[model samples]
Target chain A: MLLEWILGFVFLIVKLTIVLIILLTVAAYLVWVERKLLGRIQARYGPNRAGEFGLLQPLADLVKLITKEDTVPQEANKGIFLLAPGVVGLMALLIFAVVPFGSGVTLWGRSIPLVITDLNVGLLFILALSSISVYGIALGGWASNSKYSLLGGIRGAAQMISYEVPMGLSLVPVVMLARSFSLVEITNAQSARPFIFVQPVSFILFLIAALAEIKRIPFDLPEAENELGAGYHTEYSGMRFGLFFLGEYITMIILGSLIAVFFLGGWHGPLLPPIIWFLLKVGIIVFTLIWFRATFPRIRYDQLMNTGWKVLIPIALLNIVVTGALVLGTS
Target chain B: MGTIKNLAEGITALLKGLATTLKILSRKPVTEQYPEYRRPLPARSRAVIVLTRDPDGEERCVACYLCSAVCPVSCISMQSAEREDGRRYPRWFRINFARCIYCGLCEEACPTLAIQLTPNFETSGRDILKLVYEKEDLLVNHGGKNNEYNFYKRAGVAMVGDKGTQINEDKPVDLKSNLP
Candidate 1:
């Protein structure tokens, strides 16, 4: 029993190391991918100088960020400003803890699950961590002691709060359909068919809310570069700025994974290995996000609020009721 | 019913926008990758300024300071001196290329056809002082552009040869021959 526990501990360490490395690497490369794809969409080549197709750009960017001078405003709250970036990065990483990438695989006559932890309320864990991530933005903005950053922080806090409700409500139909909050069980439920086919309204609502939640373009009023001069991170420089970007990209990947697990039938495709299917789904979702960025113009702040509260929340509530009634009648 | 129609139309507009971008994404990018492929510039395309020699391999500049005067950025400076042969030349010509706007005004203002613009605009330097080209850096062996037109040969100046011996000049009528 002691030997078994030691082996399990070792495996856990290995898994943690692997996940961290992969997540960080993917987050870095996603920046490159987004640039290249957006460039192509706009009829240009982006960052092709560093390496073959600018593969080394992320490394170059990392070096540049590290070498840059990290400035702290004289009048700013130094402690919170310094800690804010870490909160965002840490919260993003924490959310992935409950996200199952694949089913358990038997190795060395032992069954190993491909997640850090399978929390019973995995969905709630994701929501809570995402909520906590807003503090990173809000605090980073407020601590900067600049009006632009303050405005950005307030906007980020308000937008995130407004969108969080619709985002959570949209997931209700999925939770009801799966009848379990554990991501692993949710995946198992969708072994027959992905939830996207049955609950497309939920999928659309979730997609929109998730896009707003992530502060992507068309809903990126928080960091509206033209108006806010880099928004909440106006005063952030060097590695701190890099940390914020790292957090954003990691959350993008996390959202992709969550969507895959919740709606796209997590890693259950025939012929291909489970992990590959999961990756492919995430890639598609990430590509769509980039495409949306390239296509859509940023909506007005009033339009954004109107769409969120008056439209999305009401639709999500109605969707929940209809889905609940259907589930009851079918059962 | 009206709200539903409006919603449908709004979504359609978004879908149309997405389609347009998707279509462009499928097409080839229009970027011309520099360094690997240099576009051919026209002969008259103003860029790096050069001092050209006369066809006889003589410096064409009379050091008249016309280019220096017309230079908008005041980048050109030179000390004028008369050679032992009575030909004029710049003793220590300089151009602060870092200050040059490539306006071609100096080229247009050049009376001796010595200063001309070339298409070779790839000049870059790590140090600011490196961009300040001296006479040696600007001087070229060949008579650039109008190679046959020597300033000294056509100027009717007595320096290159006697005034009557210059090209396109009328012979001096002698008073002694007119005595008949």
Candidate 2:
């Protein structure tokens, strides 16, 4: 019995190590991918010098960030300043603990799941952990003792709180359809027909809310470069800045995966393996996000808040009601 | 009903923007990939300063300090000296390329056709000191822009030959024996 426990523990550690390595590498490369896409959109070449097609830019950026001086402001709260980026980066990564990448496969007479942990309330866990990342931005900004940083911090708090409502409400229909909080179960429910086909309205609502949730373009008022000088991370430098960047990109990947799981039928397609399908869905979502960025200019702050509170929240509530009625009528 | 129409218009506009960007994304990049493929510059493009020789294979610059004086950044400086034949030339001309704005003012101020701006702009160097060019560094053994322009020939300096030996010479210098 003790031998079995030890083996399970060792495998768990191995899985955790593998996920972390892959996640970090993917997060780094996603930045490169975004830049390359943005450059192409703008009719220019982006970062083609470091390695072939700028494949090694992330490596060069890593070295630069690591070697740079970690500067602390004179009047800043040093402890929180040091720890805030950790909160953001770590929380972003922690959300992936429950995400099911692919189904289980038996090896050596034992079934090993692809995911690190299959939490029953995986979706809730993701939402909650993502909420925690806001603190990192707010605290990091407030700790800097700069006016722009303070404003950015305030903007982040307000924006996140407003958008979180619509984002949560958008996912209610998915939960109703799947009848389970487990990400794996939710995915399995859509194995035949994706939630997107049935709940197209909710899907659109979810995507819009997800963009705001991630503070992407037209909703990125917190990190408004023109107004707030990079918003919550204005005073952050070196690897601390890198940590915030890592957090942002990791969140992008997580958002991409969640969108895949909820609406597009996670890891489900014909011919191709579930893992490939999952990644393909994610790649499409990421490309769409980049396209949105390239296409849309930043909306006004008032417009952002108004859209969330007035438009999206009401629509999501109505969607839930409509979905509930349809589900009852059909069943 | 009007609001729905407006929303549809807005979305359509956004879709149009996406299509435009997507089209750009598919097209070939206009980047020259500089250093690997240099774009041919215009002939009059001002960049590095060079001293050119006259058609007679003699130094053309009289070093009258006009170029140095007219230089906006004061990047040019030189010592003027008269040769044994009374032809003036720069003893030691220097141009601090670090300060050079490539304004071509020095080229414009030059009386002789010696000081010319070349289209070669690849003057980047790791060392600041390496950017400084002296007379020998700037001087080239070929006439630039207007090759036939000789300052001495035009200025009536009796350097190459005495008066009347050259076409434009007023008369031979009245040396006492020649006068007799």
| Predicted model with the maximum lDDT | 1
Q: What TM-score would you give candidate 1 relative to the actual structure?
A: 0.83
Backbone N/Cα/C clashes per model: 0, 0
- Error in Å for residue A192 of model 2: 3.0
**Weakest lDDT window of 10 consecutive positions for candidate 2 chain B:** B171-180
Per-residue CA lDDT of model 2 for A99-189, tens digit only, reads 8888777899999987889899988998898788889989998998888888998999889888888999999999999999999999999
The TM-score obtained for chain B by all candidates, in the order given, is 0.85, 0.83
| iRMSD values, candidates in order | 0.6, 0.9
**lDDT: worst 10-residue window of model 1 chain A:** A102-111
Name the Cα RMSD for model 1. 4.1
Off-target runs (Cα >4 Å) in candidate 2 are A45-47, A68-78, A143-152, A226-229, A234-237, A327-331, B53-94, B111-114, B152-180
Give per-residue lDDT, candidate 1, residue B154.
82
Regions more than 4 Å wrong, model 1: A1-3, A71-77, A144-151, A234-237, A328-331, B53-115, B146-180
Return the clash pairs for model 1, or none. Answer: none
lDDT of 1 by residue, A1-331 (tens): 9998998899999999999999999999999999999999999998899999999999999999999999999899999999999999999999999989888799988889988999999999999999999999999999999999999999999999999999999999999999999999999999999999999999999999999999999899989999999899999999999999999999899989999999999988999999999999999999999999999999999999999999999999999999999999999
Candidate 1 docking classification: medium
